[model samples]
Target: MRCAHCHEDNDLGLKPPPPKLQGVMRKGKMPSRAVATDQSVAQTVLAGKGKMPSFAGRFTEEQMRALIAYLRTDMPLPQQ
Candidate 1:
């Protein structure tokens, strides 16, 4: 998990870990308290928000789709 909120330890005295993202898609809350759609989440991942960095131009369309799918379910990651 590249997302620091989900994988990294806060041993360096950073803010506590972010909320778990297990049902963020179904609950419509992610990156913040605001509601978000799939398109919105993709946009956020691409454009970034707050401390999160943008991933624009970093992934192919298929990779982006696969990442989103993984976030929404337990699907395996698409091969590069």
Candidate 2:
């Protein structure tokens, strides 16, 4: 939850609130993006878009996969 905590924290006062991750993969697009694929989602996470900060150089491929997996689950994300 290290990386994801920020995405979930509503109290961060982020200029544009982060989008909740649940079902984002199923929806098949990144938030506020018109044309995005799973690869594109990964790219966005790595590169950032708009107000969301880039995660580039922070996550290993395995970690990124796990994060994506967690976001894909139909079940509620576990509290950290």
TM-scores for all candidates: the values are 0.67, 0.76
1-80 per-residue lDDT for model 2 (tens digits):
65446667655677676777677767776567544455777788898878778889999999888777776774555567
lDDT of 2 at 15: 61
Backbone clash tally for model 1? Answer: 0
Model 1 TM-score (2 dp): 0.67
Instruction: Report the lDDT tens digits of candidate 1 across residue range 17-77.
Output: 5444566776677858777677887888799877667889987889778667767883322
Q: How far is candidate 1 from the true structure (C-alpha RMSD, Å)?
A: 4.5
RMSD of each: 4.5, 2.1
Where does model 2 exceed 4 Å of error? none
True-structure lDDT of candidate 1:
0.64
